[model samples]
Structures are given as structure tokens and as C-alpha cells.
Target: MIIWFTTLQIVVAVAAGAFCAIAGLAGRRPSDFSVGALALVEVLLIGQIVMAIVAPFAGNPPSGDPLEFWVYLVSAALLPIGGVIWALLERSRWSTVILGVIALAVAIMLWRMQVIWTVQVG
Candidate 1:
């Protein structure tokens, strides 16, 4: 995985998490801004996925286990998609809660990705 993209994902996830938390605490539903933020994240994730795929074939394969890398890649790509669907369906504080949960999950995945890459590199 590209460090830059991974870092970007983490930053996006953190920002999303903060927004979700604020919304939940304020007893407000998720706003269109939240959805827009998530949509932006999804777009970035798509780019990251494409980069990952191309890098491997272009002789820059990740040092991590292939299975683990692919799993992280797929799940990372899915989080925003899932968040969008959940937000649209719920449209309440629950939507923000869902986003919060997904953001936490994304953070964990990013940490795991780092660990996996580190193990391989070392």
C-alpha cells in the first residue's frame, strides 16, 4: 500500500469520526455534509485501490501477505460505500452512529495494514 494513500485514508476517517461524534452528541441527524465527506473518502479510496492494483503489477508489490493486503484493500474500499447506504437509510442520529462505527473500523483496518506492511518489510 502507498503510505501517502494510507495516511490520507486515516486522516479522512478521523475527520469523519469527529463529525459523527459531534452530530451524535448534538442530537442531530447526519447532515448532507457528512454524506459528502464520506463520498469524497470513497472517491479517494477508489483511487487508492487502483494504485494498489497497478503498483503490484508494476513491480511494487506490498511486502505484506497478499491475502491480508487484499482483505484490507477490499474492506477499506467498502466502508464508505456502506456508510453512504446506512446514512441514506437511517437519516437520523443513528446514521451518524453508523458512520462513527465505520470510522472506527476503518481506523483499525488502517492500523492493521500498517502492522502487516511492517511485518513484511522487517
Candidate 2:
């Protein structure tokens, strides 16, 4: 994966996670803003998936297990939507916290995916 794009994904995941967490702490429900933030992350993640497809043909195949890479990619991409669905169903303050936690998980998973893709670190 491209380093800059991966970094951006991680940052966006973390930022969105933190935003939902703060809202949760404030006793607020899952507002549209937070959901929109999750949507933005979802879009970026989809872009990452598309880039993954394009990269191999462009001569940037995965250095690790491609199966694992793809699984992580797909799972991470779906997580936020799942979390939001759960939040809407639960309809509790803890649901906001759950969204925050789910967003954080997306961030963490993206970092792991980068590592599996053999991202070089500073």
C-alpha cells in the first residue's frame, strides 16, 4: 500500500474514533456529524481497497499473505457501518462509545494491514 494514503487512513480513523468518543463522554447521541465522519472513513477505506486492486497490476503486490491482507481490508472497511448499525439499534449512550471503540478498531486494523503489506516505518 502507498504509505501516505495508509497514513491518512489511520489518521482519519483515529480522529473519527476520538470524535465519537468525546461525544459519548458528553452524553450525546450519535449525531449526524459523527456518522458523516464514519462515512468519510468508509470512503477512504473503499479507496484503499480499490488501490489495493490497482497496486498489484501497477507492480506493488503485497509482501505478506495476500489472503490476510484482503480479509483485513474487507473487514476494516465494513466495521464502521456495522458499529453505526449497532449504535442505532441499541439507542444508548454506550452505543456512542461503541462507535468510538469501533472506529479505533478500524484504525488499529488499518495499521496492522499496513504492517502486513510491509509498510516501512520511520
lDDT of the candidates, in the order given: 0.77, 0.88
Clashing pairs in 2: none
What RMSD value applies to candidate 2? 2.6
Candidate 2 similarity to native, TM-score: 0.93
RMSD in Å for all candidates: 2.0, 2.6
Candidate 1, backbone clash total: 0
- Tens digits of per-residue lDDT, candidate 1, 8-77, equal 8888877877787677677778787777777777787788778877987877776778788778878987
Provide TM-scores for the models.
Answer: 0.85, 0.93
For candidate 1, give the lDDT.
0.77
The whole-model C-alpha lDDT of candidate 2 against the native structure comes to: 0.88
Runs of candidate 2 with Cα error greater than 4 angstroms are: 119-122
Per TM-score, the best of the predicted structures is 2
The list of candidate 1 runs beyond 4 A from truth reads: none
Could you tell me the C-alpha RMSD of candidate 1 in Å? 2.0
